[model samples]
Target: MPYALTCTLHLRRQVQLLSILTVFSVIKAGHVTREGEVRWQLFNECSQGMLQTYLGRVNTRGFSDRHCLTEFHVEADFYGAIRLQHAQSRKYLCFNKRQRITLRFNGDSERCYFYERINHSGYSELESAWQPRLFLGFNGRGRFQSPDTYHVKRRCFYWLKFVRYVPEEELHHCEIRKPVDQHVRLEHTNMAHNALRNSLLNQIRATHDGPYKHQDQENRNGTYSL
Candidate 1:
């Protein structure tokens, strides 16, 4: 092939790749960490498995071992900031004036909260904006209270662990996702991309050829086909 033809093919391929990238970006923006609501399951590595809503339930004011029934899916902001709220009770976990984190039944004020993974491990500790030293954890007894003191027996035991949670709706949005699902999705996307490219190129060719055909016919006969 001539150099000019080779260059034309390369330019066309680049444009096609750019268009595919643009489409993927628009489709994926909704699923990134930036958009929609993100959730994390508060898992305790040593104590009760899951961290749940420790609302003013009967004998469950602080923290409990109940799994899903404890309620309140966690909501996190950018930079790993988080707030736990019970759906039915409409209560939010807020830091109180006592320098401890507590469940507030009703409040509109936004408090500062940040969480970080410990040693790049799955286990994480949630930190509060007001109290710098203390973390969100259960005390000597398994309760969901951020006491000022650390656990004397095992300091690492009480530190909270987190797993980025996906809601049921989100699950439906992506069925084939697992730890290795991203690579699969990319492969599937790339494999199917050629068909999409062919369709787009066909549409472009039809659009470009129409006007030129009409102009050529007019020049030959000095008349417009109505």
Candidate 2:
């Protein structure tokens, strides 16, 4: 009976493994359904607790002077989200400190280079420091070949607002405003002034109170010097 139970457990494990393999295969195949087809929950198993994600499609339009634009909106509490949709039927979506998303076509050699960088340097390097230049490779026809320039589009959208935290005693007197460019500069300047004023007040407090008391007495008797 124990042996039979063990065999049943093993069979169940094999079925689970097969299910996982099938999902992985679908992801690697890069298959696309009709235009309106939606694949909800397709990535449920793969994306749970995943820090990054990607989506892409092929570029139907040939290389032209026109530019492609993508917009993203994210709240401040969340790290960030980047979506890269290429004309070449390629799509990449990721979320991280400096998230990156790129799409490339089959037989594209440069895609390998990008994958290496994404793995080694990570998303921060890709968004901030790495400025990937568009390169156009030519075919033997002397024609400007190498799938016209992949119209690349990128945007950084943040929606988190910061609230000034004031002590309970100071809250009544403190004023807060929507931080504008000028307001920020003014606040910084005011902070510096306040710091300097506090430093001067501390110095005065450190001095012996005797001299200050003596001066006050003299002033009361109308004998104090300017």
Candidate 3:
């Protein structure tokens, strides 16, 4: 073989190997997340009872509880961007192409970042590969996010929602696992304890508070009230 032809073949092989390595790297890096194909649950800490209850959009407590409803269904795009669909109303939570977040029953769904923060620094530090700009935060009652909101304060907020990753099909079983507030359960247990205590006291009083016992005591003491 000619020396020049041999050199050309070597260069071609190098380029082909580089191309293959690039494709492999892209796949390993997870450019498109397959995990997003599963369903996600947004459980809010601001809810009344359990933290497992989802941050829903319908019939939720007003600004006092961040207006998060009972449940929502999360759907992800090809790029792993997510949209929260209300379980009952079927409406989607979107940015409204503005600062305020609202439920709009439109085809244009807001691309939300489903991720966690490195620290409790603020909403700005939420880690998502696709959406570093947008965030999900809560201020006890109202949930807020960035870029579309009017208030400068709304840009940064404490987390009010937590994502519960699960398959779309197993959603029904997931709902059953929603936890009850330990404090509330404890309170109920205390109330029952008190009730049982009161009942026992009443029985004791009825058994001992008899007229004959007083007479018996009087005879023993050799004294009479009559």
Best by TM-score: 1
lDDT by residue for model 3 over 1-226, one digit each (tens)? 6778677756655653353233222343656432322222333333322122234433223332322344455554565344556543456655444544566566363333344343332221223333455654443443343443424554343333333333335434423345799999999999999999998776655233633345567778898746
RMSD of each: 26.8, 21.0, 15.3
TM-score of each: 0.44, 0.19, 0.35
Worst ten-residue run, lDDT, model 3? 118-127
Count of backbone collisions within predicted model 1: 2
Candidate 3 overall lDDT versus native: 0.44
TM-score quality measure for candidate 2: 0.19
Clashing pairs in 3: 56-69, 66-141, 98-148, 99-148, 99-149
Candidate achieving higher lDDT, 1 or 2: 1
Stretches off by above 4 angstroms in model 2 are: 1-180, 205-211, 214-216, 219-226
| Local accuracy of candidate 2 as per-residue lDDT tens digits, 1-226 | 3777667656655653353233222332577322211111110111111111223322222212222212111111122212232211323322222222233333222232221012111111122122343222222221222222323211111011111212234322312244569888999999999999998777666244533445666678889645
- Whichever of 1 and 3 has more lDDT, that candidate is 1
TM-score of 3: 0.35
